[model samples]
Target: MKILQSKYTNSFFVLLTVTGLLSSCYKPKKHFLQASGNYVLALRTQGTNSTTDYLLSMDTINTASKNISATGNGIEQLAWCYFGSTGSTVFSFSYGTNNVGIGYGVREGGGLYEKGRFSFERMDCFGKGDDNTLVAIGAPWGGGSYDCQIQLIDATTMSIKKKKLTPLYMRDGSDKLNKWPTSIVVNDNKMYVSFYPLDGGSWNTDLTDTAYVTIYSYPAMDSLTTIKDTRTGPIGYYGNQVNMIKSENGDIYTLSPSSLAAGYTQVTRKSGILRIKNGQQSFDPSYFFDVETASGGAKVLSATYAGNGLLVARLQIPGSDDISKLWAAFDVTIPICKIAIIDLNNKTVTDVTDIPVHGGQYGAQGLVEDGKVYLSVTSTIAGEARIYAIDPLTATATKAAKIEGLEVPAIYKIVN
Candidate 1:
């Protein structure tokens, strides 16, 4: 009887402990996903189609420690989104699956706060209208309609201030094609958008001979003139990238990557760079940088303005000779690109030797701090994702903090 009583008592205690532990887990407690720091970086894991991304904030990203994993860290995003920053705020704009844009701000008290979120029908490309506004362009991926949507989000209110549905430039009635926007740049009182013409149904870029840029009056959505340059095939690719950058003096420089790997159906023209002198509506007549010839036929995938009329660009290695792989460029799992510093003034390409060959990323904004350019790369050769600081003048690279993920989608500094 004593043994039976002891066994019952022991079982009852075990049950009580289990219930207490479970209750503690279910206790009402506030769960906050705030990180401590002044800088934010988007660490993306897995592939792009169905991706899992995390926005982690840290005090510094230059520590040469072991790989910094994004697992079990920071705020998990609502959906797959690309980043667009204005001032001290970072926005996660919806990609393919969802239609929402979430904003996060670096708090003065050392943690991040969910600033706000906005929704729209679609937002494919982004442009910084100013310090307070973000311009988003929404083009259809596949549909019977050709109408595009544009929205301007005010950072102060975290809501879209204005929206318009109109075509940047109307296509000829006889041409059954669609203009797909790759990048948007707002300079002064004008807005410039780069696009490629493709068959809406088949996605065939048949007009592979000239690059196009449409101009619109700033803050006013109206049909403006479309500028065409025949030196390159097109200005950009499928996903919005930093293809066009405005220099300090207001000159708008555009990168045209007529490479099959960059979603071009065929490469009939040389990849190059063109400029629209500040406040002008046409490409400069005498300035043309043939990037394909300069880099021995390698096509540039993305170019970020590094300062002093220099662009830190990522060019495809062996430059996409294979036209068979339709979506080869977006498949970043394969390492097929390398970083190079391009002199916009001298038309020279210098390769960064220290950084290993890496893959392509959509909308890669190389963060410039002081004189060095910091870019996120997934070095499949090194078997890790990390940040590399490259000196534009010397064409050298140095490794920084390691990333424990597929890629660091963006590196940002937001001071409170």
Candidate 2:
């Protein structure tokens, strides 16, 4: 094991200067000490095989950690799923495939181990069940052209408990093609599934700005209604989790990137946040925070809610809409992202000072826990991959950990 220590600077002056300039003054939160727990970081190493390693560290600031490599098993692409209640078990899904893997036993001496491996047709997003079950949503590859499938898996035994499918169609009752599930959330015995209804499996500028979410009765998997909203493009993006989050009060909020590649034109709707009130299937008509407008023309790529109505977000500045630029932005090959903290209650956004504006591939890269928000800054522009611990209240960010020679794409905190 190697310890890659990051250089801590006396950069508090920068935050202090910025804090004084903002209308709503920033307040600092309590600092967290380096403690022993299960912390996972995903590194995407370049090679013909596209190898990815899930490194588990017992203590976040310590040098001791174990690596679980996914070199084979046809898992060239992967996405992290939600952590279980115990935080000892975590899940991940492979891109464009039916494969799902579970990593558990983080507290055991052997480090994190693969407890089970299973398959569904194809899944883009996942939700947690009240009875320790995992709900997966997506469509079958090369099949289910006009239908989306949902499956419930027993997380403890890794077995399929039930399955169902629903046909997708336009408002006029015409069959919708190339429509697939992007994200899902389970709340109060009901499941909400967000979908991207593409023109023909690809982006078209002429596509409507409206996105739809279908609500269903959980466990029974019966479709109740499909709701649409034109305020945002979609509830979530592909290849990322954590876009849709539920508050402690049972209200649900989701982000829409509305990226250029997603077929959102300048004249169309911009990226923002939308809320679904508790016990309501439709979006809150009066609630909306236009992130793009707040960022002075930048688009929101991803966001995660910090407790107390604060949301840490990654904003993409306006840039060329060329395909290559879009690919580079998605691959984190360029520094094009700005980290901002959004105040949901006040409807304000403030940029975090002292942190590098760099590129990160996934929107789920930010994790909030124990009064701290951990962000993975994975760009070669900084010369090394590092994680920053943000004090959301004070709006101050400090370099917490570093990964010496790997392009870390995501980080997860697991406690036993």
Candidate 3:
């Protein structure tokens, strides 16, 4: 295995002064302060055959100084991070070569300490985590025969708690060749797993105009029932976590991007948002937002809930697929197309202004904190990586900080 590393730093100091003179007495106050917490950035570097992953932590207020980095081998197509409550414990996932590498550490004294390492089968899709457990759904990476495995691991111990296997596919006995697990959410003693069915290939061109979510009772792994919706495609994509999010009000909302084209034919479907109300198993027939139409035909690539029934979304231009455009998706030289804020209540999308347009392998590269959404806007070739603070209410974006050397694809705010 080979390892590569790089670092850059920029810091800003804010000084506050107070002056007063009373009864022939003069007093002066001077102090410099920086913001608390650090922003964790996932940086991607493309090589001849694979892409390497790097983790960098920079002060939220100052990006110049006090930056730390962790380097690793090439990551698979998808990578994710889990931040603990204290903002110290972190778990990183890297998938490649028919296996998944698990890295765990704690942030201490302004650095990350590697505590342990583990491994899992290839193409394991991550599920949501609670206070104690982390779940992973396993399936075949390429089109082949394999049992769908579910592994529940103890979050703190990093040890397997339980493992269960289902049939080749869901219990429905469907003959679909590719049943890809997209996202998983555990709610009310049941685990909801969303899937995208393809004919039999790596590309998602043979996608059906339908949605499938299999519900299984937790811990027991007993098959409950499969929910179906012909109104939309899959709930989420392969490289995103925010596709299905639970709001503060307890309702669950999911976004779909059906943007694959088959041979001499295209899947003409409107990508939209679907909701599963709190305390319900099926999608609410009364709730649906046509996100594709809202964006004037642009498809939503990734999205995250930004409070108040609003979502900050990254959109791809219509017909921007690599197969159609004759360019590879992993080409770091591509620029981002657009960013917008979607209002679920009014079913509207307002484009955010004044951000650089760059292209990259897109995912849920956004985080919501203190009523603001922090997004990673990095270009593959033109400009440096930048973190933008977006106000969902005003639909405006302002540059927050910058990362040199690498294009950051994901950002997470970890409090200390």
Candidate 4:
């Protein structure tokens, strides 16, 4: 296997132009995949930029964070989703560039740090799922004035072979797929995608909001097929954020960044967990976790199933405001990242520990085995990013590793 390396820089313009030049005009034929690998985590790395030229590292961990290749622009977002088969570990994601548009890649690992390769052209990959085959949603950049299509790509080759699905928005006043696509996850053979339609629409001053999710099924991996059956979400909440994990018992738990109560609706605040059963279309109202926003309201930094009935969730609490410094032009909000152990059987949560972290501090990306939580945080006095491990029972954290090189470091983990 060849070791892939990337160079990090503030510029990606040259890389973008080169990526476009490498793509072939001839389209590849589709194949019916029999099986895939078991991917335990979706390790991702991104530069702390809030704009279009956001860069991403190809290898999640084990390898140093390097910028995506052959592009002059940069990566916007990097995410991973399982495709091909039930136990198959095959996964894919995309990085951004100016002329390169979007660059995508696939890997074959079940651990935190494993090697992978760069594959195809700049397809605006929105989200994906598996039915023995990889079914993805996105459209070509210059395809049309208004064009939305879902294509099925080869799991091994990472090439587009079939155009299977597309959005059929609300017609004659009916509802449709949300325009702002955020995240996608799958349970059983069903695909759950979260999207909000504020992309091309004008920003509204109204407080009332609408977020939507669609549940659909595609053909089996052996069939070079398409999905015609689709269902839209029922009348409910409005927002385009999603963080989901599938439990050992086949239950789907999705986290949202909205309040379930009134008055706190428009704060861009609060934390919530929405539960949905496997192969279901709507969320189970009874299984929801709503954290407060005032008086050090809790925020879910990250969450993952620790197997069995145990779900580990992370929370952060900001310190109280300074009344004496009200006259000052700017203020600092010190944050404390905490971990929680949730007893899913009883639908209850217990505070583990605050994990001793500060603002812009390193935080845990996801949960790990053995009830241990990993976090990357800055030493406020030391001014450096360090990795830490927290024990859930004692609610105490210990320094695990110190990330080198950055004045302020960004660290993420992947496990085999």
Candidate 5:
């Protein structure tokens, strides 16, 4: 589609800090982890006007003696971005100001470098397509349009491969409103993009009693069908969190966080999980996991699939969802977020008691290695920013690496 190129290609924002080492060193996260790869962390700290992000490639993250700081240590992104990875490339989709996506890669053995970048119209949410494609959906705002611009990026060359202006299909077969996309999941040769009907002008989610996912053929990018399930409010929430995940057996599971904590004015249906069996285009009628009830009425904040029918989730503290404090769900000081393990198969929520309660998490993509997912845990009580290695099955967590900044929103292990 000939995506536009950024004019400021090699611009690097210099970051400085005067504080000394803020943490003590420990040991590697896992001894059995492979030694031939590098770990990349996108560290986000505050700037004058917006947040500043830096991609730091390091060897170890668990030791208190080792404090990793974004200061003069990594690739500084243009601005705050929504991140997602496919294959070896990590994409930083610029949000708020710039409409460009820049990709970073691991050096021969250690360090980070920019692979390429391309500008686009707008990409509100992101998904991984196969091993070489990064999919983005540019949804309209404020009752302006019904067309969602879908674009695919070739990770190899870091260019927009193709784009299509696909229109939304409402229940009445009339496009009077716009559907905002939450996430995209491509599996089994089909692309699944989940959305919720929204009145842009009113900014209220009127159709919040059903889940919607549109299926399209892969590579060919053909819209095959639109599927809806009334068991949940919608297949996703706001702030670009991943709402769907594909398991090992190729079954796609979608999470509907119909919670007011995530900016939903009214949550009609219960927050839940729905699945699409392998090689199928429709939701599995027999499966529906009531996550809201499982979490004891607390609103789900974020979730990342951790294989084997388990998901590492963050839930708000019961009775802490105060919409009056705008975006309080993510305001780390609120002390309302709890880390738990969700079993999709048995429909259970196991609370991990080792970690302290915090505000909320910003990253949607969790870094999983050696059967444990690495999460950036920041607790006001703990008094430090650290990476907690959580075992989904056991529902336990161990403080691994210490981060000197705010939080490591995105992490990736690049085996170059």
Candidate 6:
């Protein structure tokens, strides 16, 4: 770790003196502290929204710094294909065409087709496929439920294949797909598919809303032999980013966020931790986590078991609100992000620290590989989302690197 500078020391000392003299002291936080790392910080000029794709070469960090090997240029999404214990390789996919517009002005939320919004186009799977794999899923805006088809792409060619997979509900036993697919995850040799309903149309009004998880055996994205019950938890909680982890003793846990009602005051949304333990196919009915918020509820952005009944989670504070609400109550302070150290053995959740939100709207989206937490700060003021390396053990942040030119930084994981 780098030592605090003498100039900072003097400046802080003066501030501390003023704080002590004032009726209410304002203390400075160590938000911009520097720490040392052996890894390279690479920049790419040809990515999804930004101009670059980045693949960190941990094995070759000693030889190159800021040197990223590009997978697919001029694209928004990328994923590493991990062939289940056979090792891993890079496979990236960019929609051949632009379809949706920005969510707001020139089309708001950005273009759907241009930004990989049609399905899990925002998500990439990292698994070996025997010539057939569900590479992307989602609905192209202004399309029907059938518009939500799953693209079985050719891993080698990085091209969308002719064969596509759709849920039983979406198809007529023929090869039709749905329009409201949400998220996808692979577990225990079975593929879990979650689907939702589309909004703003005639069929959208007739849409009988439901979510499904279709499980299929490996090597075949075909034939949904078993339908897993995903309704064990609360209703109306849209699930995303399902992950599976196994303990050394052989117990399995599935972790994801279960979003609840919105905040009464702020634009914050509430979510709680959802855990399915002991190889169970469904969520435990009584296993709701305790996350209290008037506006934004408890949300688990990223979670991983740390063994011996401990789990580390990257949590975001409630700041996501409607623009009108923000304008009405304009003096709202930005909530500081935090990391919760959950001890399942003791059944307790401990607040680690105020993880530091520099500027406005910055939140943590990724996990740190070396037990540290990685946070992505979307500073409209900075015009980029800066990634920070948080030492969970010390509750200190080390300014790591920045991801520039993104509308917002989504989930990312450390590969090294």
The candidate that achieves the highest lDDT relative to the unseen native structure: 1
Candidate number that wins on lDDT, 1 or 3:
1
- lDDT tens per residue, model 6, 183-210: 4455555555444333413212122222
Question: Where is the poorest 10-residue window by lDDT in model 1?
Answer: 1-10
Using all chains and alpha carbons, the TM-scores for the candidates as numbered come to: 0.89, 0.79, 0.78, 0.54, 0.87, 0.52
Per-residue alpha-carbon lDDT of candidate 5 for residues 1-416, written as tens digits (9 for 90 to 100): 12323222111011000000111111121111122238888787764534566677888765557666765567666555668888989888764344568887877777777789888777778888878888888888557888898988899989998998887456666657688888888888888898888787655676788999998998777999999999888877655776888899989888887765565667789888899999898999999888878778866666878888898987776766544533455455557778899888888988999889876655536788889888887778778778888999899998887878777778888886
> Which is the better candidate, 3 or 6, if ranked by lDDT?
3
Q: In model 3, which regions exceed 4 Å deviation?
A: 1-38, 46-50, 61-88, 96-100, 167-174, 200-204, 261-266, 319-323, 326-332, 380-382
Q: Give the winner by TM-score.
A: 1
lDDT of each: 0.76, 0.60, 0.58, 0.37, 0.74, 0.35
Model 1 lDDT tens row, 310-398: 88889887645565544455555567788999999999998887989877766667788888888888777878778888889899988
What is the total number of backbone clashes in candidate 2? 3
Candidate 3 lDDT over 82-180, as tens digits, reads 222213344555533223344434354343445455676643466655656667777655566645788876666666678888642453456655666
RMSD of each candidate relative to the true structure = 12.4, 12.0, 13.3, 11.4, 8.6, 15.5
Judged by lDDT relative to the true structure, which candidate is superior, 1 or 2?
1
Please list the residue runs of candidate 6 whose C-alpha ends up more than 4 Å from where it truly belongs after superposition: 1-87, 96-135, 138-141, 151-162, 168-179, 200-212, 222-270, 290-296, 301-316, 319-354, 358-368, 380-384, 391-396, 402-416
Residue 390 displacement (Å), model 2: 1.3
Q: Sorted on TM-score, highest at the top, how do the candidates line up?
A: 1, 5, 2, 3, 4, 6
Evaluated at residue 312, the lDDT of candidate 3 is 86
Where does model 5 exceed 4 Å of error?
1-37, 173-175
lDDT tens digits, residues 206-309, model 2? 45487578889988989899888898776565554467777888888877777753333323567788889988999999999888787787766666678888
Compute the lDDT for candidate 1. Answer: 0.76
